[model samples]
Target chain A: MKRNLRIMVIDDENIVGKRLKPALEKEGDIVETFTDARNALERFSEQQFDIVVSDIRMDDIDGLEVLEQVLARSEKTKVIIITGYATVEVAQEALVKGAFDFIAKPFKPNDLRTIIEKAAKELGR
Target chain B: MNITSGEAPIQTDDPQFSHHGLGEEYVEDIALKSRPIISIRFRLFLAFLVIFAFSMIVALWSIYALSEIQVKIRFLEAAGNYLTEIQQARRFEKNFLLYGTNLEDSLEHLRTAESILQKNKDTIEKILGRNSIQGMSLQLNNYHKVLEKVGEAGDTEERNRYEPELREYGGQLVSDATNFVVKEREAVEDALSLSRRVPFYFLGILMVLIIVITSFLVKNILSTLNRFLEYTNRIGEGDFSPILPKRKYRDEFSQLGLAFNHMIRELDKRHKILIESHKLRAVGTLVAGVAHELNNPLNNTMLTAGLLEEDFERLPDEEKLDMVQDIIKETERSKVIVRNLLDFARASDYKIIAMDLENLLEGSIRLVHNRVKLAKIELQMKLTPDLPPVHGDEQALQQVFINLILNAVDALPPRGKITVTDSKSSQAGFIEIKVSDNGPGIPEHILPRIFDPFFTTKVKEKGTGLGLSVSQGFVRRLGGNITVESRVGGGTTFTVLLPTTEVPSSVSAAPSP
Candidate 1:
């Protein structure tokens, strides 16, 4: 029996979190969305997520820091970094820092969901 | 706004008048560039001062030297007169002794000699300072007294006795007179030789002084002039670095240099403003293009989102997801366009690094490949193997090539061919990248203005008309140039000439075993 996947979405834009919450929830995953990176990082520490999708540019804690923190807490957790201002250098840095994948902004929600589904399979769900 | 009757006072608010003002300013700018800031008068003054001083020194020296020679000649003439008087007295004494002529002729000759001797006494005194020639003067008086005694003798015995005495006296007198003449002759010769030698010595000294002074003046003028030349050369090459005059002396050259430095500062300020205004204009044009470009993707996304919403219940989950993906993809497309616009408008600091042309060309081709493919364009790349690295900013140069390629793609018809060729330029130390396309060629009249900003042949939506202009700007900053050649029906070729970095031959030749 496959259990529900745990996903965390962090973006500074309120619409991004609002849109992704319902979209990911429709896929039968327990998705938690945060518009503030600090609040999201607090939520991340309180609970383990199967897949952590984060925006790379944010006030306080960025996606790379979130990735490092998540990986430090749970090595199996997949951290995916998204950015509006993505360059080859930023993408490579995010991946080198233990991100499961790096995707530029305005990406399809399905693109993220596909990565989350892969993370779920890795979790043996 | 309402139009009044024709009889109403004629409105004087013509836009052409404002444009005329702008034309005047532009003409003024041209005049400023053409006219020399340093006045010719200042330079001429410097040159005239040097020449005038040189001529003045030469004139004064010659005058003094000539006058010295004249004074020596006068002295020589006085000595010659004294020598002539001595010769005349001796000749008469010889006539009286040898021919035994009448006493009257003898006495007359004696009297004439006495007066001539007295007349020349002052000249002798002038030569020998009155005391040095007293012995010569006393000898003349003794010869005169002897000749007078010979004339007064009464009988033959008296005459005979006095004659022998007179012969002895005459002999002594002649010998003394000969010595006086020789001494005077030597003095005159000494004066003549000295007068001759002094002028040459003075002239040699004067020449040396003149040469030293003239060279000093010339060196000062030349060094200042050279500095001005170097400064102007730098300005000509578009370097606006301030010139610090080598000397702070308040000379005309220094003042001119100061004025030049001030002008350069002004020019640099004006140049900065011109660049800023140009950037603003480019940004304005880019904003228009960006807004238009963004409209299409935004509209597509909005329509797709609305459809997804309406069909949410009836459509299959896969179809719903596809629609959502379409919206996301459209959004992303708009984002990419905006990013490119911002990158084009952003004023980035220039960085020059050695870059391989092969990789740059491939990257640029890849960027435009999808559009090129969709347009059914045939793309041919003939990049020479191991083309030398050029020094430039990679991203900027990449933008340049991508812009050129896209422009070529835009100009092409269906199934057109774009040939990108790279080779070492015939101009040494440079490499050439040529992008040639076979399409409906640019019009002959329009070709010259192709690289001008905001000048476009395409419909407004197709281009912002900044691509070629921006590319030219980038190429120029990289110490290169972009030029286009087109014939009305014969397609267009854009040639980019870039300076190559001097890579060591050994590095390119072979690797060590």
Candidate 2:
């Protein structure tokens, strides 16, 4: 059997973290979630994760910073950016920052799960 | 507290009123506020009339003086002739006494002199007094009697007696005639000198009157013209208040005032529509942010509902119910966001009501939240809690704040801070609200004239140059004002001073200039 994947989801909206934590956990993987980007970044320094999922817009630290910080620590980790406004500039910028994938907001949990699985598959390489 | 965020439509709150802020009533009302036509021409005519009457009086007095002088000169000539006749009679008397010549000629001269005295008795009496003229006539009769006595005497002794009487009367007559001629000539000279002085005196008085009238008219017209010149300057700065009557009587300038009021109404109408258009443009700007903002709640709802559907059978009742509640709450949140924007886009009159500046300021900040977020600017507000309410139009005030905030956002780089601070002003009954940014400050040269209409540093597409001009106009109309302080490379702050009140303001009566 494949090893359990590690995932962290950061969104300022508490609901996103609360709901996504349980939904992703059903896949038999460990998941961490944060409603604040600062706390999320603090927690991120203490451990290693296989994938980082973060909303692009945040109060203190945005998703692009999370992506840079995550990659600076562990290049193997996959960073996926989530955005409420999926304009081309943001999508292009996120992708340019070594983000593994970009997803617009309001997507079904399964859609994100599929991207995470793909990111997981790539982590094995 | 947040009526704008409420679901009920804003228009229903004031059904009797409409978005059409003004109508033709004001134009007609102002144009028709005319008093009687006390035109400038009428005033000039009255001035000339006074001058004309004064001139006629002077002319008539001069004519009277000339006539008096003529009468004196005529009487002087008659008196000179009487003197000549008396002297001639005396000469003839001397001849008759010396050579025994015929006395007829002397008698004839005496008769002519007496006739002259008789003919000019009234005039001579008027000049020399009734008593003096009568004494002179008695002397003349005595002299004539003496001469006749000398001529009628037959012996030398008789003639000798008459000779002394005749010589005495003759000397008296000559001296008296000379005195009358000298006094009457002096009277003629006095009358001529008086007539000459009359014209000079009239000229001095006329000059003084002309100066008085001319200065009065010049000052009246000039002061009014200066007032109008100042009015043009005020109106050019975007003050649209009508020119009201300051004088008791009307004049041509009053008609000009009416015309100014008319022009102001039209200009104000065009400016209102411009502001309306700018508001629409602002709404357009907010729509993009609003659309992006809506997705946050929608995203939450989607994630929650999706999970609920996937785990519907396996989930505990509590978990399912929580997901359902989350979905409902998120939907309600979405509704409020949309409603707030809709209320701002709706047009309203300059309706004055007591409003919480804190709530209104916060709402304005929220409207531009997306623009600020997109630019990564840090926007914050520090309002003193429990501050008294201010009187203003809610929609218009929101626009004012939003414009200020948006301008700050545009001027800032990413991570720049925009601080909105408010407190009670030092002036009584007013609150001062300041919107400040730490971005590269506006240059000092451009600071003062930023409130001028069509004066903008931004590109044509980005700015209509009416934002601050329109904002200042609105605030002044409500008896408030906006001021700005800026330093080159330091920062910029816009302070809006608003009056706090409990009653609906009679601000429409306020002269905005």
Specify the highest-DockQ model's number. 2
With a 3 Å backbone cut-off (N, CA, C), the pairs that clash in candidate 2 are none
RMSD of 2: 6.9
Question: What is the lDDT for B344 in model 2?
Answer: 76
Global lDDT scores for all candidate models: 0.67, 0.83
Candidate 2 share of real interface contacts: 0.77
Candidate 2 CAPRI category: medium
The DockQ figures for the candidates are: 0.02, 0.58
Residue-wise C-alpha lDDT for candidate 1, range B1-513, written one tens digit per residue: 111000111224432122222222222133233434444455456656765786677668667766755664664564455445555555665565556565565556556555655766676576656764676567656666766776676555665666666666556655655555576667657756765676677667767866776676678678778878988876654455555534434356645655665566555545445445644654575465456445545544654565566447887988778778877887897887777666555566555667778877876675555457546688999989977778776657776887788788888987799999999999998999999999878888988788765578878766656567657766776678999999877998999999998755412321111
TM-score against truth, every candidate: 0.47, 0.77
**Quality class of the docking in candidate 1, CAPRI style:** incorrect
Model 1 stretches with alpha carbons more than 4 Å out: A1-125, B1-135, B144-156, B167-265, B351-391, B402-432, B439-491, B497-513
